[model samples]
Target chain A: MDIKAYIDSGILELYVAGALSEKENKEVYDLMLQHPEILQEVLEIESAVIKLTSAAAQPSKTNIFSQIKEKLKFGNKEVKVVSIERTKYNWMTYTGWAAALVVGAGLLWTINQNNQLESAVTTAEIEKAYLEQQIEEAKTNLAATQNLLNVLRDREIISVPLAGQGNFATTYAKVYWDKKTNSIYLDAQGLPEAPEGKVYQVWSLTLDPLTPTSLGTIDDFNTDDNKIFAITNANESQAFGITLEPEGGSESPTMEQLYTLGVVASAP
Target chain B: MQLDTLVSQFQKKDEKAFEALYNMYSASMQGVIYNIVRDQDIAEEVMQDVFIKAWNNSASYAPEKGRFFTWILNIARNAAIDKTRSKAFKNSRKNLDAEYFVDILQTSESLEDTTDAIGIKKFVSKLAKKCIKVIELLYFKGFTQKEASEALDMPIGTIKTRNRNCIKELRTIVLE
Candidate 1:
């Protein structure tokens, strides 16, 4: 058989793409194992396609496997509960107590079973709510991400990379200043969590005279997953800075606590 | 072989193996779903459902029939297409034109984070229109050779050879 000719026929690409029929796929599978070159070619094609497709993907905000794991875990627990009930039923028939005691124990067992069943129903409800909540969250996150992408892609939006400063040199951030909307999207993904009673405050700066205007405190920094906050910035500023301040922020910019600073490249 | 082992373990209901496979292909599946549904939220819902369905129907899978990646890819494509056809989806999203996967790849925000960022950019920029359509139909859309032939208004044999050549170019661009 002419292996090179067979390979050139492009059957392997179709095979990897699953465009082949069952019989054709089986033949390709058999040939792949038989010939190292065929197997190698198939692997390469698959890898390249995987890379191409993955480049288009926007990954989920939360871990999807954990959700699957939770589902599988729930299934296993239900199975175990069923088996335990079966074993308990088998033991119930072997009971031999006096009539009165037996009645009393039976009532107690009934109550216990009823309580267990109630709790089981409650658990199932909770699980259902949790799953529903997760789906809702995923939907909201996706929508938010899409909106963020659109905003970032806007032609008029200016990108400012705020480098870490002073003692907080390890932390950094970015500001997407949209002049049209009078808003700046601050992406503080690189900043560490604000300590208790301390909130990160943003500021618009004037470079020549070295003046600053407070842009308010980030109270929900700990809760935001992306750490990208959109704050109204109507100021015609020259630079941007972030400072750690006590909760509710301070009157003036805390220059000593300034965590990051960046000069706007094309400040108007 | 490692993938084969992981797939076999996944077939045996091994969570670890399933997780490994999910991590490996979830991005690709998301990309495929995103390309079809074109809505990130709907795509996400379809992606989760696809994997859960794959896990539930794992026993029905046979290695001889096709590769595991191909199996999951089929599920993703079918699920996304099904979502588009759903009444709720239709009502919410009116008029979903047939868009190529190349558009998604080029305009994707997360492109830089992908391992194939540079190669993919180069490939898409350099790829001919014919190659894009062939790849979009055959690979991303899971179109059969005949369907792709009809879609591209080309012969089946040409579809096969063209897909082969396109993939060959892809290999050079991405796997080199």
Candidate 2:
């Protein structure tokens, strides 16, 4: 290669422009390394280009390198992993998670409280209903007792005392016959509870022929709160008796099961 | 430190080497950026951005590709040209019709204050009109031999030889 011809060819000037292809750039780089003259010429062309380009600039008042260093975080690279901004951001993240957990726990507590309150309200409503039912039952009992007192005190009513029979001597009862109402109020308070499949049958009796007329069986004897029962008796009765019979009561009194007998005091 | 050693250290992310490189080339980059954008503030902004980019992409640079100065000069020209095409830059700067980089030498009062600018001012004044256009296209604008040949309406050989003579003249005024 003619070194002077290569130098005079103006390729070195174009090399400074960075306008060459990659192959041409590699060729120029290799040539500059092998030859000292080529290297010197390239350096001169590059220096002149630098001066010419620098002439176009208006010399700025402030150096922008510091601003660039700040942008690139150049000097701060070693300390970047432990940067205060990163620490602050991590703290905020942890605080956010903690806040979320607190809020979640608060929500769970509120929900639990709400559920407990709802159940308490339900229990209170059930208790209120039970109390109200008890009040209603007491009122009904008071009214029934007051009406029974008025019936017993009436002057037109005839009272009879029934004595318990042989096997049930301790069991006693009373009958108040209200002729005006044609009804008898039987107070069987002293009577024992009727056995299953057997009911106490009341009968209106006459002593002339000892005839017994069946009234009716006491079906609700076990369930009645007060043992007082009102029964219609339109027959002209001189006496009354009670006997434990079958569930529906018999046409005639069962003599073996007679529990009580009473004679009307004002009877003819 | 030697330029090659400093550049090598810069590529390895040495902050001191980066600063050395920045101080050496920032002025030239600003000049090339100013010529394309024709505004000092925008030129400075683009110049800073160019250096920051060079730092970030330092690993991509190789001596086999080109000189470090040439590499950064290419980045500055492209960044400045991109700035001119931006909507904000176009709206702010209605007229950026400078024909050559040397035009700043004649018209700019901004350079009058700096004593360091005197030598370059003399060089630009003594530079021929043809040299100004050729250098502006080749070095400042990063135009290829074919592009510059088409732009100057001359043959590729003439552009190369003319650029050589122009750089030779520049060496006499500035480098010699």
Candidate 3:
């Protein structure tokens, strides 16, 4: 290859401009490596272009270098610090999880407390109802006892003991008459229970005239706890008699079925 | 020193070699950038960005492709052209194609401050109008031979030879 002709071809100027194709650039690079003259010529061409273009600058901007260095320094340091700070934030993440777990446990405990309070209230309510029922039963028993005490303590009451007669000789009864109040209380403690479909009726009698007046029947004779009953007496009764009758009381006493009889003693 | 060794050290994050490379080429790169952008501030800003880019991508360079000066020159020209195409540059300067680097060289007040400014002024003043357009397109604007040929309306052969002779004259005046 003729070196002078190659140098005069003007490809070297384009080579300095970086305008050559990549293959041509590589070929030129290889040639410059092989020949010192080609490399020297290329260098001279590059120098000329640099000087001409540099003339267009107003002045050399040598001061901007420090600013560029500063930017690089800040950028590198910021990246390093950001990574370190990110690692430090791991503790905050764990604390957040712990707080959530604590809140969950507190919520569960509160629910359990609510359930226990509700059951306790239910048990108290049941106990209160049972006590109320017992109070009602005691009140009934007290009223019955007071009625017995009042009958026994009356000043105008006359007590008469009726001995069992005839077929029911072993049966007995007593009558307490409160003539002022026009009431009589019959105590049939010694009497046997009447058969089914039968009741015991009381009678106020005047034995001189043999007249009988129906009092009332003992309807719940078998179930009475004290076997005592109160009946009204507006008659001028000389005696009292009891006889077995049908379920409801008869109009007059049954003489043949008289179970007990008693007479009131005058002024005694 | 070989440019490959300097670039290798630069890729290894050697700041001193990077600064050495910046000192050697930043002025020339600024001139090329200012030629297209036509503003000193914008030119300086683009020149700084170009060198930073060269440092960031230092490992991508290989000497078997071209000269290191040519590599950086290409980067400077591309950055300058990109600035001209930007919306801010176009909004501020509308008639960029009307002026060339020769006009900047002829009008520069800082020419006296440089060591070879007088020689560059004389060489640029005596440069043919065609030679100025050819070098402006080929080197400063990073145009290929065909593109420069098309822009100047000259034959490709004439563009290459004319550019060769123009650079030779420039060497005689400035590089001597």
* Best model per TM-score: 1
Residues A30-54, candidate 2: write the lDDT tens digits: 9989999999998888887777677
Q: How would the docking of model 1 be graded?
A: acceptable
- What C-alpha lDDT do the candidate models reach, one value each? 0.87, 0.86, 0.84
DockQ of each: 0.47, 0.49, 0.45
The segments of candidate 3 whose C-alpha lies over 4 angstroms from its true place after superposition are A60-62, A74-268
* lDDT tens digits, residue span A1-268, model 3: 9988888999999998998999989999999998899999998888877777777777644456766676567345332322335666866777888998999999999999999999999999999999999898889878977977887887668988887878888889999998888988899999999899999999888989799988888899989988988899999998888999988889987777899988887875
Positional deviation of A228 in candidate 2, in angstroms?
Answer: 99
Going through the candidates in order, the fraction of native interface contacts each one reproduces equals 0.81, 0.83, 0.77
User: Lowest summed lDDT over 10 consecutive residues: which window, candidate 3 chain A?
Assistant: A74-83
Model 3 alpha-carbon miss at residue A247, Å:
99
Q: How accurate is candidate 2 locally (lDDT)?
A: 0.86
Off by over 4 Å in 2: A76-268, B110-119
Q: Quick one: ranking by TM-score, best first?
A: 1, 3, 2
Interface RMSD of each: 1.3, 1.6, 1.8
lDDT of 3 by residue, B82-167 (tens): 88888988888888768888888788898888778889888877788988888888888899998888877889889888888988
Error of 1 at B176 (Å): 2.1
Query: Can you give the lDDT of residue A177 in candidate 3?
Result: 90
